[model samples]
Target chain A: MLVTVVGNYPKIPNLPRPARLRNAFARLDRGQITPEELAKVEDEVTIEVLKEQADAGVELLTDGQVRWFDEQTYIAGKLGGVEINGLIRFFDTNTYYREPIINGPVAWREPILIRDYAFARDNASRPVKPVLTGPYTLARLCRNDHYSSFEDVAFGLAEALNAEAKALAAEDPPLIQFNEPAITRHPEDARLAESIWRRLLSGLSGETAVSFYFGPPGDAVAAALNAGFTTVGVDTTIPGVLDAIAAGPKPPKLAAGIMDSRTTRLEDVDVLAGHVEAAAALAGSDNLYVNPNIGLEFLPREQAQAKLVRLVEGVNKARGGAK
Target chain B: MSKGLLTTSVGSFGKPPYLAKARSDHAAGRISAEDLDKLTRQATQEIIDLQVELGLDILVHGEMERGDMVAYFAEHFPGMSIGGLVRSYGNRYYHKPVIHNELRWDGPYTVDMWKYAQSLTDRPVKGMLTGPYTMVDWAFEEYYPSRRDAVLAMARVVREETLALQDAGARYIQIDEPAASVRFDDIDLAAEAMGIVTEGVTAKTITHICYGDFAPVYDQLIRIPVDQFDLEMANSGYDLLDVMREKGFDKEVGLGVLDVHTHKVETVEEVVAGIKRALEFMPPERIYVDPDCGLKTRTWEESADKIRVMVEAVRRVKAEYAIE
Candidate 1:
């Protein structure tokens, strides 16, 4: 079993406190500070995000997606024919995202994510798994003003993302995980979600992982695994999801979100390890991968790093040995 | 109902750019404590003037000093310390509060702020408190025996604040509870918890729930012991008002007639139509009008424009009905 983040590390460690990073971004936009300085700061701090994961003994790692503006907006804005409509609530959290609307046919403008992935791969001691927002989530989040139907828009997005995935794979990373946080919100979209993900991951060079969070995956878990992906991450903390995965046609690897990243409350190492053990037992396989239930971006970058340490500790405990 | 379709904000006007920086500077220790407080007071006064110029019937302090609703209160209250940042939704995040001991009202959390803002405006200012259930739901429960215990303890603490505002000569108090509708499984528990806080409060009590679907807990929410249900309507095209019309709300209804989540300003005519549609469903005498949620997420200009349009629309509706 391997441990890794679903996506996102805190962009800037609190320079002195919470929200300073946001203030700095506001300054950058207003031309008080140049973009180069911000990138330099992000690059310098990103090492800490990666080192925290590696130091915690997490097997697979992520670049922490420090440079992007927000989760989907940065990558989606990299594509052609996608425009930001307006800000919308991200999930049940206090966060908001600029809704990316499909204004025309979705197409990749260039290799948007390769450099971001390569940044992590170069800095990290551990193998970095790059995270992407799944095509279903991207399409579902976008306003389909130009598409013929939901299916048409979704397929367009899928192809665009598949191209991006192949480009990232060219960097020879271990796994390219696409996060579909929205799928669980609308159970009616499960079948379509599976198909869109299938379209996106088809013909990818490296390993692939698909996961859902902020809510239970419901029946979508099994449907997603049928797409010949290597891993499926289930947020066991979201209630009823553990049982849902227990009843699954298990994937080759399961990233069980056994600890929460949404809150700063620390988890007891033994208790969290028990959750991993339970998920493994229920799945009837030790293919269980342990990690935070959601992206660590919800935490302060330094605090998120601390959680990663605890996360790997739980994973090690479940393995019945120190890593 | 007695207020006769009054117009007001849902509290928390958008922070001006300077004010946001002042806060950031203050936190980084680049500015003195007194300087930050002075800036906050000045911002609050400006917000008051803006609401007055907009012709709002009721007023809010704009919560200029608040970083996040729960965190602001948690800092002042006992047994609660603000935790690290957690994503609430898209680009928005709040520092979650971690509660380890029994909650107690250390003193007046918002009374001084309420007194200052009210002193500046002739209009009745709503004393805003993050409702006990929300504080409990949004916090990490480090010491509570159960979720129920934590919520109930928070209720007692809130009741203390509400009564302090009442004693401070405030007539209206709003306990904003936007998180209530998120946890559907805890609706009954949330309702019961709310009852404990509003149990004996003398001020006119209101609760605001926004951003979540109201269908799941409407029946239980209707029975909550409060004077008004200030709901998010315009964002849903007032479909929530339609549901309330069908089920019939016996309590006063504060109709959120403008969307506050966006920066785009609504025209006066658009606001007029929203109020007109809401009036057709519920009795006009029992209606109060406001934005769909706090304006904190919007730009200051957008918040002012939306509120101005809303107040104008309320005036047009009242003139149509020939109410004094």
Candidate 2:
């Protein structure tokens, strides 16, 4: 079994590192530095994040999404016909996101994450997976002034994001994961989300996964698996999620989101190993990938690093050997 | 003076430059605790003086000692530990706290500040607290068996603090549940927690919620066991007024007429228009005018300018309507 993270990692360093990225941003706002200067700081921070993940034995890493203001706006702000607005709480967490106000037809203006993804891929010591916010979530999270209905926004975003996905596929990474936590919260949108996922995954050559957290994906589990996704991720901390996965037309791969990422109380290694063993039983060890229940952004940078170390230890324990 | 169109802030004024610097020095052990307290009182005095000068009806102590609302309480409370930095939004971060053991309230957290602020003015000062649901929602809870247990326990702690404030002669207590609207599914849980927090308190209670799409929880919000709902209306174009009008809000409303997030202060006319729109639906006697949220994020100059505009707006609306 391989250990991985869902998406974001903390951008802030542990301590005494001077918070170069945060300070650089403040300076950029003050007109003390240019956009190019800010991007250089972002690059340096991304390298630090990649180094941390590599040191923790994470086989797959992300750029820590250091460049993103928030998950929703980072992509939406770059796309055509969307404007970033004031902060709203991201899901139930304390963290907030700048909302995307859809003012006109949603269209792919350019490749949003390609540069950051390329930066991570170039600097990372391990495999870097490209992550995108799924169309359904982007649609659901946005203030839809243009679309007739929520589903319509989802459809519009689906077409728009498909173009970006195709552009990313040209980079030829092993897999691309679309985060659609909204489908879990509003299971009523599962039907629309299924169609959107199909549209998004239509012609991508690389492997694809859909990661859902904050709760059980409900009908979305079946919807994602049936959409021909190579992998389906579930946050096992959410009640009924493990049972739902057990009662499955299981996908080819399972990213078992077994560790709670939001809380700082480190899990007992034995307990974590037991969770990995249980998940392996559901979807054979070869098909299993261990992960935190969601992105590690909610935890402190130190805690996030510690959690990743624990996750690797658990995976190793379950596998009965050191990698 | 009229009971209608009461002017107030939604708690918190931006710290002065000297005080902000003092806080940093104190944190790094370059200054003494007494030194920090003196500067905090000085900053509080400045804010109270400004509010009085602006002819505002209610005042806040400006939260000079607090680095973050929830974390401040976490530091005071037992069985919790101040954890590490986590991003709250764009270019902003706060030390996210962790509940490592059972929650306990050792003593009054805000009574001294409330007392000090109230002593400086004849006008009422709000006894501010981070609400129970918000405390649980904002922190990483490691102790309690479930979220409900954690929130209910926190409510008891906050209830003690509210009672302490009342005992110390606070007329109004604002328990800010900014996270309540964020978790719309748990509005009932938040309401139940609020009930526990305010059960024995005699002071008028207010809960401030912001940055949420409140259409789904508007009904539950009205019933959240508080005397008033201090909402962020100006930032959301006052869409909440439509919901309140349709739902028929019976309680007092702290109508937010100025956007606090932006540096640009609203024109007096802009705020007057917002208050007038609320007046068409709800009576002025039941309305309290304020900024959309705390002005902690703004510069001291910006906060004062915005409050000045808000005060002038309320005064003009009152004069025109003969509200007194």
Best by DockQ: 2
* Local error of candidate 2 at residue A312 (angstroms): 2.3
TM-score of 1: 0.90
- Error (Å) of candidate 1 at residue B286 is 0.9
In candidate 2, which residue pairs get closer than 3 Å at backbone N, Cα or C atoms, i.e. clash? none
| DockQ class, candidate 1 | acceptable
* Residue-by-residue lDDT tens digits, candidate 1, A1-323: 77777888776555365454565667787899998886776776677778877887777888777676667788898899988866665666656678898888899879988877788789888888888898888877788889889899889989999999888888888778899888888888888887887888889756788888878888788778777678888888766777777676867778889888866668889978888788777754457677898888777666677778887777678778423
Lowest lDDT sum, 10 consecutive residues, model 1 chain A, at: A12-21
Query: Candidate 1: misplaced stretches above 4 Å?
Result: A15-27, A238-243, A279-286, A321-323, B1-3, B14-46, B85-95, B120-122, B215-217, B261-264, B297-305
Off by over 4 Å in 2: A16-18, A27-38, A145-152, A321-323, B1-3, B264-273
Tens-place lDDT digits, model 2, residues B204-319: 99999887889988888778999999998898888889988887889999999888888778998889889988999888889999999999889877888888888888878989
Against the true structure, candidate 1 has what lDDT?
A: 0.81
**Model 2: per-residue Cα lDDT at residue A102:** 96
lDDT of 2 by residue, A107-138 (tens): 99888888889989999999999998999899
